[model samples]
Target chain A: MNVLNPHLKFQSQSVAKPYFVFALMLFVGQIIFGLIMGLQYVVGDFLFPLIPFNVARMVHTNLLIVWLLFGFMGAAYYLIPEEADRELHSPKLALILFWVFAAAGVLTILGYLLVPYAGLAAMTGNELLPTMGREFLEQPTITKVGIVVVALGFLYNIGMTMLKGRKTAISMVMMTGLIGLAVFFLFSFYNPENLARDKYYWWWVVHLWVEGVWELIMGSMLAFVLIKITGVDREVIEKWLYVIIAMALITGIIGTGHHFFWIGAPGVWLWLGSIFSALEPLPFFAMVLFAFNMVNRRRRQHPNRAAALWAMGTTVTAFLGAGVWGFLHTLAPVNYYTHGSQLTAAHGHLAFYGAYAMIVMTMISYAMPRLRALGEAPDARAQTIEVWGFWLMTISMLLITLFLTAAGVVQVWLQRIPEDGAALSFMLTMDQLRVFFWLRLFAGVGFAIGLVCYLVSFMQRGRVPAAVEAPAAVA
Target chain B: MSETFTKGMARNIYFGGGVFFFLVFLALTYHTETTFAARTNEAEMTEAVTRGKLVWEQNNCIGCHTLLGEGAYFAPELGNVFHRRGGEEAFKPFLHAWMKAQPLGVPGRRSMPQFNLSEQEVDDLAAFLSWTAKIDTNDWPPNKEG
Candidate 1:
């Protein structure tokens, strides 16, 4: 009998395969550009004229966003069908949207690289729409419209499936999150001439997505994976999911004020932002507890040990990165010195990795084996390698954050905290922090090695795995 | 705890709390927008200042430098650059010289690419920076080296 045959529960779940593959490819690209930027920090003129720091940074950040979106789309495609207990409404539509999104994303990144940003703007009719040059929203106006279209198609495909099939809380929450993502993106088109007003509304898209709705996506995905690995009751997981996301929004929605404190907003945000954001870590703390609690209560030992490890790892890092590091500078008094510093960069890298990136990887870990018909899990050695990959990436990321935090502390001390006559200039402060930058670059290389190991684990499979044979023997 | 803590209650809290806090956020936004004219030096926003903002965006200055403590932190904060360099009469000339100096190619030092901006564009950027420097940031940047 042939092994490696597709044993998918739903025929349409295969539509997610291309998405997952494309996402990982883009993830590798994201890391490459990240390493490039990290090098530029130490070797200032490494690629000065050809690929400037701004361009490299833009590519680094934008690729991170796009790949994560790909990951999210893949997770939804896989999770929705299983949750609904039905085949996808239209796998063809899903595949088409995937191509459209992938093409637009690649073309936009090419445009950024090949053309001067100003030339790209003029060629793309940015004068008419004027939506370029904003951080993370720098996609040309046409690409933004394309993203909206792809989002609509995706939502419709997901919606129709759910409409005709089961309606579980996991599906409902994920759907709401996906819809919110599409809705909030419309704010990217609303750039104003007034800079303050421009920034005030920009958070509608950025803050609301990550802190507000993306938590819903992350939570639902985690709950789904926990349910599978723990053999826990769906009701129990779903309940915790709701409570976690509830806390995320309750604190996060108001916590948006923290960005407002120094950005020409009123001083009242000083009070409001501080109080609300101080409580922001509670949800992340709850996540750590919830993950451990679910594992402790698991009825069966999951064969996919790597997937379980990823799920547990996601919670601890998200708490430390997003929750703890975030709390360190969220206060207006502290942020006054630290805003726009490497401290923000540290928090950003860790939080995105822990909360979003790792969850997507967790989903991939859980779903890919079944999607590929590799049995309930890959071989034992593959799981061992993946566990190693997880630790390497996570520890190096923590080290990167710590190095940057040290750099930020020193920068603030020398630059921001001094009296007018005594303060060092920005460039001088940067010069003093070269050692930390070198350390961060090394940690980044470690992260890239971890990613390679992760990719390698996919290629390593010996005979038909024991997990695949266990169920047959039971039958 | 499992029996008493139902999904329905959790769901209710999610919806109810989400809407309630979102409404509060909108109210704060409304208050902030209404005060922008006073708070952000809107009265000083001349035609040149508007063109200066366009110049800023066209060049992607915010790509490397921060304005009002937002944007990439690769370069110095430019929100108060007008005040830091030289205010009023001398700031414009300082900016003109600064823009002309291309990629100070000092081997290992960070380099700024040459944008080849015109005299008018440079002056307009000066106007914009000057206007931005006047925004009531509640005494930010602590010192002049922003």
Candidate 2:
């Protein structure tokens, strides 16, 4: 049909390979930072005792955002060309984007270590310049401006690709989710004068990103990739994607209630928060349906390398552990007790890493091997161990989270006194909290080992045989 | 009837879930606001609650104290104040007593400051405490100790 179309000669996947490679490198960075943060909880003065807790937290949070963003950017770059039947507008721009992003990420981290406010003031000119009062996590205006510019450049490249290219359900959902990341991040730039207002707006960035938009990015990307790897019909995947999007918006918009439960908003907030937040499970449940159903209906043998199986499995565990457990505490009544405790951390870890981070890793794992198609078929035995590693890490993390939640409940009950009773001193309560943190540290180590083994397995890719198959349907 | 059932089934499965959940939200909200407040007769003690509300705000208690399990867990749950400290009578005296005894020599834990509240303020704060405890939280704060 296209006798002279020069673009038709190239494969859709050719553009995506570089994105996959970059994501894998970022994944390594993310896990190492996570291990350090987990260990610091157990031993107070680990990794530069000079760095304050807030600075460590800033590094931890910022690293997660960067790596996850890299993963998402790579996945979109890789997937859009595959699903949309078009080429990226410019490879040179994409490479330039990588260099700029890398520079920004490094500078931001260094800025964080040097300053008390996560390098916000150096970026912005704060006249009063409270270097480190520790009242709130403050940053300079320039740092905020810098982050905004970084987001704009990345979004512009992706946006132009999507605009000039065709739109599929997957791309549309991804575009919406990515736009959300840019929109919500604006709130992170400034300190709110009113603490209550500050918290109220802060969740607009943190809670909304995690519970709301991130799920959209996660669900769409997972479904799109699974569809490509497994030979699922486009119709079926599209239907599943729609259901997830519907569920995310329903649960996500109202799910902001869970955060409001303890921020002294209103008694009404608890009921509103719990009921809507309860529905957060619906989309995730749909995801489990999508995965098992797709795998079940596969007409051909799946390319069962370790990355394929483990990446797919990440979807299932994330839905159950992060979505369901998260719902348990969504109720204001329960959150009334659980907020700000290890219980909250328990949900955050699984929901953040398991649901959000796992999806990113799943994409990278699936795409990376194929991109490197240097006749290196991944070894079956190595793949098996890596798949096992995924389960081990996920299960260990979930166990640690649940244990911390139980500890938090105990802390709330024991520390509180009857209105007419003697109160427990704060010091006494913290003494009891040490053991749980230690337990979390142990589980974290287990999860970290699983991560290490999985990484090691990635290094063992052999050669793809000539008979290795391509995706069945191009569209 | 089968065709009707087919159409009805699809409609109900989707819309029904929404309707059912919405009704549950309403029922829970009503039950919380109405049932226990009526039984406790604690609503009549408005003055004490007003005083307590003032105290809670003036001291930025939400900065530390949690009501209905909301706010900081820094202090104990005050949602069940009346039952926790014995009764309404014990509530005021208890506040007066705790306030007078400040800077308890507890090691490690944060110390509560002495607010030096007047006797009337103490009574009002206690009444507010009682009022909050009487609200039907559906058995929240599972233990009386906290």
Candidate 3:
């Protein structure tokens, strides 16, 4: 049945729908994981038996990566064919790959949830199995391999389509991003025993992939999709792409310095990390430029109102929340005070969800009307709900991040004096900071509600009528 | 030919501007190659300095102690070892002799592990340390302890 079904098709439309489901599932999973982690921070004993912090953290990070990939894959399926002006190459291979991917993703999630890092041998009555304790999360050998396989499968189908179909600069940029994803990820499989050196190499995998290359892919995808939907000039979109990529490189490389401050690295790292991290906001600011400029331009107004504004919303919010706040504490000099604090959480929550998550949602919402042809346009009031949700969740998060940032500064300057043992002082500071932690809990609840609104808005079709707003004016 | 030429031209101009700024950033980065106070790879070596270097290398001194900007930062900076040892003549013997003198093992205190060094190599290593201390680092390390 799976083989014979047309839904098993490899074409762009076939790929898009499944990828959308994959994205939403992973996104909701990430939010849940995030809330779990936040709760663990506030009350360590909250979910002790059910989900350990390590397990929850692993789930959180893994879900973030998975959902972003799903969104990218969907975008690739949709955009590549449209640019190529040809149908997707092989429906059968696509479906086969899809099932394989889905199966692998499930297995990996189960592994994370169930597999104990060490003492598996101790637990089961066998000494034969090696207790590679750190390997469970830090080494990440099996998960890394799974990710590599998925990348290859995704790249191969997309590559074949691009190879046979007419190609453009946008597709080329996206392909470059995918290739970066592949190359950088292979480095993950390498497990260095030296913890210090291993950290540097891991950053090569983690930092470079996100801030460096993935940014390229994301910028290209967002710009290309916007141009198509907005009917804007290709040159304007392409120009926006170059600016984004440039800003990404500038901040990405130096931004790595922020991670270096506490890790027993060279002292110069303090300077390097501070300077570049301070400038990290440039790309995000450029993101603002990218969003507002597009909206300001006169173009063929796409009839779908909610989805269109969300598309622009992602850029602005990412700029304010992620880019600005990311720059705020990424400086090693600044991070000397802020590292590992709740302020870091503040930066991450908005930046990632605002920038990447919004883009993914925007893409999914845009595709919904087209794919189902419900054009849910006249009734598609979900857009307003989603947009308002974006503001509510994001502003609450801003309050949380700022409160924590202030707490972090106080902790660093006041509590951690080398003359007196700082550990106890740090303890006292945390006691003082409990109020902000409570605020974070409050914000998390608000954010969760906002996310629920997002999911419900997308899901509430055929149940409640979607009074799709008439295509609103862009300005 | 009446196709939207103005918008097309504007996009081209925008793309060109973006490329121009990107190149400017790349060019600006060329000036950022500043290294630390002490030379990590020193070539100018005398007999005493070389043997002292052999001692530093043999012990893998970088495993714990940082010299100038290189090595681990767990212990205090040794870039100003000569001054810290109280001048070259005073410092050379101190490096050779400090090892034989071990700190009483206080339970919580972080102490250096003692490696038994022969009298001659200790002096050589001390001399090398003194020589390195004499080199001007141009007021680097900002403060003494870095």
Candidate 4:
């Protein structure tokens, strides 16, 4: 599997190493808290007063958001410089902003755990501009302000680095995504007295982030990887990135209507949401076709087998998770039965893991070895362990989604669907769900084990492997 | 075959398409905002309702209970609790009693901590929820047992 090096200089890329390390550490923390939450779902009070379900759940969800942001930031720091063909504008600023964002994130999480919710709200000046307690965006108003500051600083750094050097399509697209992320976040500051309006704009932050600009980021990252690993023409890959993201925004923007169906918004949302979101999977499907086609047509096989595996895994699973499964319950009629059920949970776990988490890890997989080996590939044993980790986590996640989907169906029938003159009480329906919850918990343990393997894989040191060059495509 | 798509076209589409759809989202948002007034009958939102909404946020109730099926799924959906419990009369007492029985000391069963809410605070919280129950959620929860 001997292969050629990328030929690019390496010092600028080394800046991304610390952020990746931090994100991986936070990834571990997220999984630990996730396992805790999974147990509480069944045990009713696993940690009880000490780390109540709410606190644990907050930690779990917040850690996920924080770590993904870390990944994105790391990816930008790593790739933007190379795409621009220059060193970062300021590595010192990147490091400083990293600590600032990380510190704010930690303090906010501690606030959630250490003080009572009400007391914490007061202590953090939340009442001055109340923005706490919403899902996902539960940071205090000051914390939210800090996020904006960090984001602005980040965008400035990336923007300046790209400005001084050649601006490739990858950098441009990634910049657009990062800028959109910052802009959409402003909606979190708007919490009017109107709950309907609050929820409406709240989707601007949540839905738009995942479905809208984030797709641009994901597409560009995938494109960069494809170009490097497959030796595909940069022109071929960049054009595809553009087309894929265009499809994404087209369907994804109106696709936000899907969330509006039952949220007391206009009746038209039922129609709009269903129609647009149904098309949301198109871009993801295109991504799959593009990846496999590129691999099949590879001019050279990259030495990083783990990176290739992750890239393909991300494509296939994202389609199934965010695309197919999302479409399954996206329409108003089906959502009526499945909204807020375990079905949504099922989609969430897979979609985030497949789309965002895996892509970030994909970048890490491809880039980390280069960093460790000083521009050479990781050892075969290390790559094998990572490949193993990928399967264990991915398969367990699939099983978890299946169990949750099954639970959602049964719960909907018994609790939401009526029979004769009655529906089951929430508790009674939950009682029936214990079996599925238990299964999900088991799957979760498998996922945790996989995560440990992934972490250990990084530490393995051995003979570095020569790169693998793929057979040329037959004319 | 040569590539049919160009980076210029893709970049244009990215910017143009992003703006076009975001405009659509904004238009829909405008429609939702204007029509929401009639849907929610928000004129009924008194100071007490405002206070109740504050209480709901202060307590982080959404962390445990979902309102309008949007929050954590840890507890029963609180969006329709008012209607499910048979309106304000039946709901108030049940909510009060539920709050009083904190951590029910029942092992292997989920417990709700006592917020030690005042009587007025309880009334206001109930008011907020009842108001939420009245929102035009298109008959969500699919049944009164939400």
Output the worst ten-in-a-row residue range by lDDT, candidate 4 chain B. B1-10
**Chain B TM-score for candidate 3:** 0.64
Supply candidate 4's per-residue lDDT for A29.
Answer: 86
- lDDT of each residue in A369-393, candidate 2, tens digit only: 6565532225565567678778778
lDDT of 4 at A369: 74
lDDT of 4 by residue, A29-140 (tens): 8999899888988998787878887778788888898898888998999899889989888888888998998899889988988988888888988878888888887788
Q: Model 1, range A296-412, lDDT digits (tens) per residue? A: 999999989999999999999999999999999999999999988889888998999999989998998888888777778888878888888899999999999999999999988
For model 1 chain A, the run of ten residues with the poorest summed lDDT: A459-468
Query: Per-candidate TM vs. native?
Result: 0.96, 0.71, 0.71, 0.95
State, as a TM-score between 0 and 1, how close model 2 is to the true structure. Answer: 0.71
Predicted complexes: DockQ each: 0.77, 0.06, 0.04, 0.69
Worst ten-residue run, lDDT, model 1 chain B?
B54-63
Q: Write the residue-wise lDDT of candidate 3 on A1-475 in tens digits.
A: 2333232223345567777787778778877877876665556445653565555665676678777878888777877777777877665666666667667666666665776533222343222321122211232344455667778877888888889988776787788778887887776654333223334445556766767777777787778667856777877677667656766776676566566554434565667667876777787788777767786783977766766677777787778776777877776555544455446656766777777777877777676645544543424465677666767766766776776676666555554324343333333455666676677778878878887877776665423233323334332
Kindly list the per-residue Cα lDDT of model 2 for residues B1-146, writing each as its tens digit: 13343423432443344345436544643544343335345446465564455455444354335565544444555666667666855766777788788646344334455555678877777776776665544445555644
CAPRI-style grade of the A/B interface in model 3: incorrect
**How much lDDT does each candidate structure score?**
0.89, 0.62, 0.61, 0.86
List, residue by residue over B93-145, the lDDT tens digit for candidate 4. Answer: 88888788887978888767667789998888888888888999887778876
Residue A19 lDDT in candidate 3 = 76
Residue-level lDDT of model 1, residues B10-90, one tens digit each, is 999999999999999999888998889999889889989878887887767777888888888789999999889989888
Q: Is candidate 2 or candidate 3 better by TM-score?
A: 2
